[model samples]
Target: MTDMPPLILWFRRDLRLADNPMLAEAAQTGCPLLPVFVLDPETESLGAAARWRLGEALVAFSQALAAKGLRLHLARGAAGEVLERLARATGASGLWWGRLYDAPAVARDSAVKARLRGLGIEAKSFPGHLLHEPFGIQTSGGGGYRVFTPFWNAIRARDPGPARPGPARLRGWDGDPGAGERLADWRLGQAMRRGAAVVARHALIGETAARDRLHDFLHGPVADYPARRDRLDRRACSGLSEPLAWGEIGPREIWHAARSVMEGAQDPGVDSGSDSGAAAFLRQLGWRDFAWHLLYHFPQMGARNWRAEWDAFPWRGDSAEAEAWRRGRTGEPVVDAAMRELYATGRMHNRARMIVASYLTKHLLTDWRLGLDWFADCLTDWDPAANALNWQWVAGSGPDAAPFFRIFNPQSQAQKFDPEGRYRDHWLKGVGADDFYAAAPLRWRLDPAAPPPVPLIGLAEGRARALAAWNAGKA
Candidate 1:
């Protein structure tokens, strides 16, 4: 048995050990495992904030592996070439990894698998990133769903099964695998510049931290999620987006935990009122799945308009107004506060996200792709599928999108969601403002005491302009 070649485990977005199907199956083989992570071209192309966050996830995952008496070998280059070199060097006979659905990953993985198998090396991909396979659920016509409600109905009752527990012990491959790059040398956070330090203050890294967060949310705040999830002043929403984005926590674990609360199986302290909230929270998760489904079925979704007719609509490109919006100087209190929050914390409340996105697309009449690109660069919790889908949805450019006439009045939105102005004042004039200035690039020359800028366009004026354009485009 000692003479047997090792099996290579490639780590990508699925970084955790527990509830990880790939890791659990690999452990059952009782063979020495060579864990590796490759910084391939696809990964290198991630946005600055996402790249920096990946580095944090890698650090935490490395620590977790060390605790289990295993080592994660770091490599750089094209994934296929890197994996082949490591396999040849280590005499690895097989390789396994969790599957990813994004177009780039799918293409890369397919090519890698074909090339590796030509050498007679065993390669396998497992499903754990998403709750269900993207193509698994379909309409009666055997086609993918376009609307979310029917998609939600199709999957809401199906059980994803219990979460898998991590292996207690694992055998590591003996001897050095190959020459590897040090994580520090990679400088994944180089693009982040000064913003890294500020965002770190709000980040909850590592698998353990993610699990603890899930527990805390389910035990208390989840009960109010139904009513307060959109309230900017309340902490009623789960802060699991970052964890979920990095695969620090699997969705099935969250699903089961929430189910336990809903069924009164795990926590008796949760009142019956929580049932509605738990159910509502589950629907949000379904939305996450639906986003991926749309992405899988429509690979160009992130780059092109899902509805081809949208191409005819006139969308303004980059300009002074757009720059002001990005810098949180648009003079709209709620909008500025949200943008500032994104700069300071690498995250903005869900309601804030919609408001800012609406203000940019409908009020400023700017292209949605610009806002999407900015978010890709700024958000630590960025998911390619979700970001693109949500942007298109708000812009009324995608399937089942909101109507173009449905513009968000930021002032009215502030009154409804942030009535006391606590959310706005905190991010605009309080500690959040201080953090924003600290994180802002030195070149921006932002002043903490500066009064908010005057509104770029009047609400009614912008609304009329947008409607006229929309009507013209339709005609």
Candidate 2:
């Protein structure tokens, strides 16, 4: 090992080494690098699916490092304490990590940085997780972008540099790199129960898989992404959510690769936006950036309504109805199918997510938090900023929120989006019609011949009730 004090590359959400600004920075110092991942308190608090998938990713990450003649050390405890201990034991000089934006993470990182600095250690954070840091972009007024379009435009105005390549080798670790707890002992995957079996069939793990998936999508799916993304039955969207959430890939890599694809597709005669599908898909990524923008500005936005006035809006606390929603027995085909899809795969199509969130908040009149918490527990791709912002957006209680009065009629949504009812046919296969009606109120079971299931509340009735509650809250 080199006599120079090594730099500790602390791994968190930014898991991949490629396009990793910190790793690249640390490599330049020619100091040995010690990579470590800690299952700290905040990480422990992650919802079930998130934790399980994280454990799986950690193993993949370690292997990826090993292929390059390095080992990812694992430890468990408070991150600051664990890092301090590791730094002492490993003789590390400085620390580097990709930055995180959520409130809890900000607090944790701030404290750790301060502690390390006081001890004559250098602690630095870099950008890899997002192209534009949440707080970095601002409107002309120097405030967070509450509206997404302007946010996208403003960020686009700035020149985000080209993406960097992955490091060749990380030379460090005088002792055993696997000197911490065994991954199996963590038992993170055990949280999934039966859901694990279902999600495993669809999961794409690690950096290579992420890159391959992106390549495959750009080759074909991006050709039709603009019109096909909303089709729940179609695989037109980049199913990169899980990997993106776990930081197996970074946004800059995605952004540049997409730009390159579009540019390559353009012969001199073709316009830049000719690949409308790729452009539209990239806009969705902008939405992810928008989510962080809101969260960074309003840290409390996750657990509470962003439009605080909505706090007075009456939310029905019906455990039975909410339970039915959770179980995918709500008697609404589209809504039920979406919930079942989420349960079975720990993922829901974006359109399905909007429909169910709307149904939960507007039709059933439950708190958005209920649905948000449930998604947090179950979604393999569950992102804190995306999930929170979206739930609140659909609930009409977020920045630039959808109108609360614009309640989605599930049957109509299913007809329009899942025209053939293919989504329902797939997810609702084993679920009988009568089984759905059993969860509904007795009066709702009016059409036995039409379909065995009937809605728990009529759409018209639900709309009227929701509007009255909204008007009352405003008054």
Candidate 1 per-residue lDDT, tens place, 1-475, comes to: 3477889999999899988999999999998888999999999999999999999999999999988888999999999899988888888879999988989999999988998898889999998888888989899999799999888878877887657977898888776786778999999999989899999999989899999999999989988888899999888999999999999999999988888887784433222323366777877888898999999999999999999998988999999999999999998999999999998889889999999999999999999999999999999999999999999999999888999899999999999999999999998879988899889998988877676689999999999999999999988
Question: How far in Å is the alpha carbon of 228 misplaced in model 1?
Answer: 0.1
The per-residue C-alpha lDDT of model 1 at residue 148 equals 94
Candidate 1 backbone collisions, by pair? none
The best candidate in terms of TM-score: 1
Error of 1 at 281 (Å): 0.8
User: In model 1, how many backbone clashes occur?
Assistant: 0
lDDT of 2 by residue, 1-475 (tens): 3566668889999888788888887877777778889999899998887888898899899998888777788899999999888887767788888998999999999999998998888899998888788888877889888998788777653545656888876776566443688888988977775456556766778999999999999899988887888898788899998999999988888888887787787622112333386677777888898998899899998998898788888887758889878877688888888887777677889999999999889888999999999999988888999999999999999998999989988888888889998888776764433333333234433344444356788888988888888888877
Native-vs-model 1 lDDT?
0.90
Off by over 4 Å in 2: 176-178, 267-275, 430-454
